[model samples]
Target: MKLISWNVNGLRACVNKGFNEYFAEEDADIFCLQETKLQEGQISLDHGEKYRQYWNYAVKKGYSGTAVFTKKEPLSVSIGIEGVEETEGRVITLEYEGFYLVNAYSPNARRDLSRLAYRLEWEDRFRAHLKRLDKQKPVVICGDLNVAHQEIDLKNPKSNNGNSGFTLEERGKMTELLASGFIDSFRHLHPDTKDVYSWWSYMPKVRERNVGWRIDYFLVSERLAPAIADARIECAVMGSDHCPVVLELNGF
Candidate 1:
């Protein structure tokens, strides 16, 4: 099975920027998107008839949202974690016969980190939510996680110290998640790979210099590590500042 995750920045803007063409070329069994930044009735996709689409729009239009386009029908679909009232559309869980596929748009701390406390709370709830799902079946999780997990994840770790996405607190949560039997598919495959990033800053020359962060990812239950065929970052794609990340599995 093949899965792809990307943060499109804005679904409407991306549609005109070869989103349809790139999406068609990838031909993933399941595709998840984050940072859609739209609301209900904002945008639509016509990707032939084979793919079934599921969207969770935010209460605030042109804010945060997520979507899942899968060729295989899910047995069930959930919008957010239990006890969490997610008006921002941060979580989407699709239950398939083989595994549960979850796409998450993790909350960002912002430049001043004014929302850092809220972000931390969200992380706790999210971790608990994933653990609950694990009790039922293995999970294939992906999307724009919004954190640079280590020094290797970003270009200039020293300069980014304590920055919103590169803070110790944020990265620690990721460590805890992996410590609890979750595998970062790309990093697991290339433990020491450097300068391989998924999201680039939209400033003048960040992308050109390859100064970016691998904030997007595909993670799975530890038991499925052997099934992981390949993990890649499609850096050449250009629509959003972020690019697509892919994970290939041997069995469905």
Candidate 2:
């Protein structure tokens, strides 16, 4: 099975930039999106009839949201995690016969770190949610997690240290998640690959110079690591500040 995850930044704006063309060419079995920034009836997407669309929209207008277009029908679909009232529509869980696929857009800590506390709390709850799903079956979690996780995850690590996404607190939470029986697919496959990134800053020539962070990911239960066929960062495909990250598995 093939799964692709991307943070479109804004779905409507991305469509104008050729999102549909890339989507068709990829032909992914499951395509997950983050930061859609729209509500129901705001825009229309004709992803063909084979894919089943699921969306989670935020209460705020043109704010954080997520969507999933899957070729396979999920046995059940749910939004948000248990015990957490997610007003921003950040998470969507689709239960398939073999696994639970979770698409999440983690809350950013903001440039001034104003939301650091809330972001940490959200991480704790999100980790707990994933653990709960893992207890039932292997889980495949993907999207823009909003953290660099380690010094190696971002370019110019010394300069980015303590920044919102690279802070010790945020990075520790990611470490804790991986320790809790999950494997970051990309890192698992290419432990020492460098200069590769998924999200880039909009600063002049930043992306051209490849100054970016590997913030988006496809993480799966540790047991599923053996089934991972390929994991990659599609940096060339552009519509947003972030690009798509892909994961292919041997068995459904």
Top-lDDT structure, candidate number: 2
Compared to the true structure, candidate 1 yields what TM-score? 0.98
Compared with the true structure, what per-residue lDDT tens digits does model 1 show for residues 2-82?
899999999889988989999999999999999898877767677889899999988987898999999999999999998
* Model 2, TM vs. native: 0.99
Tell me each candidate's TM-score: 0.98, 0.99
Q: After superposition, how far is residue 140 of candidate 1 from its true place, in Å?
A: 0.8
What local lDDT score does residue 13 receive in model 2, on the 0 to 100 scale? 99
Give the lDDT of residue 31 in candidate 2.
97
Model 1, poorest ten-residue lDDT window?
39-48
Q: Which regions in candidate 1 have their CA more than 4 angstroms from the true location?
A: none
After the best TM-score superposition of candidate 1, give how far the Cα of residue 181 lies from its true spot, in angstroms: 1.2
Q: Looking at candidate 2, what is the lDDT of residue 169?
A: 95
